[model samples]
Target: MPDTLASNPEPAETRSRASELMALHRAEKLLTVVNVWDVISARVVADVPGTAALATASHSIASSYGYDDGEQIPVDLMLEAVSRIVRATGLPVTADLEAGYGDPGETVRRAIGLGVVGCNLEDQLKPLPEAVRAVEQVVKVAEEEGVDFVLNARTDAFARGRERDPEVNLADAIERGRAFLDAGAPVVFVPGKLTDEQVQALVDAFGPQRLTLIAIPGTPPLARLEELGVARVSFGPLSQNVALTALQELVEGVQRGEGVPSSMRVLN
Candidate 1:
């Protein structure tokens, strides 16, 4: 006999919530995601008002376990981390399934089983054609499983410094974005600091509602970003970096015979 879940579609409530989660990016306001790598961070972010969704940062998650990013961590271990994050929140959860780990279809199946309703599948080191093919397979599996998952296809040309000329990089990103979108990805994510002109060009070419970019220190503010018509804005590993940097400061201070600062104190 077929497994009940495999045969039967997701419950209406689950499906409705999934749809609502996907709709947040299409709204006028920017959908800001503070990427988390653990249950504690997941709980903290989910409790904040106006958080549309939560996504796991694969780099941070790998770092937490003493592994570098780029699929260094095993897929099972990564999905276990994702499961903990999902258990911490009722809101939609998206996992950064970096390059789909190994097999995108299998990775997505495991992600869906863990209650994830969305994912960021990056191009990573895969060539443009290969990335598009992977995206197509992931979408196919998600639809077959009746998950209706939000597949956010990530392009890493700019972030990885693939091309010498910035124009060449931008052109490649746009081309990949089109292919991914055509392959059934709901959004295309380009992570890196892009100039205002470059950002505008991506938005205009890709359609603002389907373009998602990582937020950086000097990028335009949220209000300005919304005006620019971006679908989503996310901090890939910035949150973890900020938190760790503060703790590192405290550790150094303690080593220097100085007590923790008042601002750093934890109340009982």
Candidate 2:
């Protein structure tokens, strides 16, 4: 048997939250996450009646701070932003630690320290073995911290290999996803503007409730994704885009001498 202490090292509350997050992924019900960049967004989503858990969009967070994605923002700054989000709500917060910010283990340790019970660590199409090892390192760190961290191991084959044959990208995603799962991640996150057929292929390969997806344009609807057995569907940076679009339209309307929309709520 596994060492109980090594398997569960978090405080009672923290462990409970982590377990809750894990259970959300394992359930038949799809976990819908509207990724947030800051505390306000976190609070807004958490206030929603059915928001099961919270997730962070690294791209949104970086862009909010006027930095680019791909780890352009400093690690400490990202952690600080995550810390605020974690503190802003009682729900579990899963971060998108893009490629682990160069130190998968250490970054996860720090994120766990900040009350993050889960995270999305993308492979960025690295060599299969190297990416799998990174997943292992993150799982090890989470185990050491005693939290059943929901490692949404992301395979970016489709995202990065758009120029290549669809079959090649699909094969790469399946291979990396299986490797990540074998290495210890609970679910595999495949992000791209994928077709319904491609989504079905992943769900079939990973099995029901074991695959996660990002909701991009042309993606299947939530009901369809749930039917396909996708455990989770997150908006990633697109949530921020929606918010920004509203803001832009509001400003443009104001320039035309129109005031704030009467339908706006004081969410902040």
Native-vs-model 1 lDDT? 0.83
- Please provide, for model 1 over 1-268, each residue's C-alpha lDDT reduced to its tens digit, 9 standing for 90 to 100: 1111112224454466568768897887888999999877887787778887898999999999999988999999999888878766777888999988779989998878777888999897477789889999999987887767888899987988754689988998889988999999988999988877888888888887788888898877777778888988889989999889988999999999999788853321
lDDT of 2: 0.90
Clashing residue pairs in candidate 1 are none
Model 1 C-alpha RMSD to native: 5.0
Model 1 lDDT at residue 254 = 93
lDDT of 2 at 164: 96
TM-score of each: 0.91, 0.95
RMSD of 2: 5.8
| Candidates' C-alpha lDDT | 0.83, 0.90
Runs of candidate 2 with Cα error greater than 4 angstroms are 1-10
Regions of model 1 farther than 4 Å from truth: 1-14, 264-268
User: How does candidate 1 fare on TM-score?
Assistant: 0.91
